[model samples]
Target: MLMGLLWASAAAAEAPSMPGHPEGPMAISSRSMTVKNLDHRIIFDRDVVVKKGDMDLQADRVEVILTAPPNEAAGHALSALPGAGGAMLAEDNVERIEANGRVKVVQGGKTATADQAVYHNADETIVLTGRPETWEDGYRIQGSRITILLKEQRSVVEESRVVIYPDEGSASGGP
Candidate 1:
């Protein structure tokens, strides 16, 4: 029963959305799962993959932490038994997610690879660490850490190196 609830919650996690990508439902699969209701945490281990629309996330393990609604206390009856209240309880409670061990994320024409990635729901930001690299539109950025602000459609690479490719039609020499 606990497993069933955990699966349902994971399935209901909102799909991440980028500027041009469609917002679809997230689908996640893994070899094993564990749910800690008391701690409001869920873990997916061993070849975890999450997909939604044009985005895909792959990692060895993924952890989800749910946040209590404002004015609501933690470990409430509704939260403890997420399945009891149907999809609403499961979907909106997610606070943050962490993907660890060879984390890779692809969205639209962009791809990001890292040893770990964390997504914060409240701020709509994703932070990648451990030799993070991102490639998009013939450009690539590599750094120790990468922060993507989904709401603002901005990315910041720290301790970074960048490569940009000129357009095919652009003049190579001064014209």
Candidate 2:
């Protein structure tokens, strides 16, 4: 009787697991995923596979990397958990999160995209390359390179120039 009960308990514990909560801390797949960032309100819908410590998350597309005010202070110092504040979803055609496509970022009516992008949550910055374009607060800026500096709350464009695209004429009246 005791032996029978032990076997049943073991079998029950062997049930399938869920994403981000797998048995070991890792998940893998050939599909796409969507990831979202709560803090920034940023969403990434593309092919992506991510690993956090011992856990693995994979999908054809992913949407994530949203940001919000830190519960404590502005620019408060703390180490961040890898792939902690987002969700990954699966879909058809393994979505590539890193390269060879357009990446869109939306913040406060501003939209920006680039061929490639890297989001560093620890530094609170995003780097976009390859003909990056940005539309923010009725201003549009395009350049060969763009660096979003969240620390100072500004976007810096390198090469070419920064142009403002507004519904009306350029609001700053600079040209």
Best by lDDT: 1
Instruction: Write model 2 residue lDDT over 1-175, tens digit each, in one string.
Output: 0000000000121212111111222122223332222342223344544443332332333333223322222342122334643332221112222322544543223345566665454454456687766544434556676655444444556664444444534432321
lDDT of 1 by residue, 98-149 (tens): 8999987765555677888888777777788988876555455677777766
RMSD of 1: 11.1
Model 1 ranges off by over 4 Å: 1-21, 68-91, 166-175
User: Model 1 misses residue 48 by how many Å?
Assistant: 0.4
Candidate 2 residue 51 Cα shift, in angstroms, is 18
- TM-score: which candidate is best? 1
Candidate 1: lDDT over CA atoms?
A: 0.58
In angstroms, give how far residue 31 of model 1 lies from its true place. 0.3
TM-score, cand. 1 = 0.70
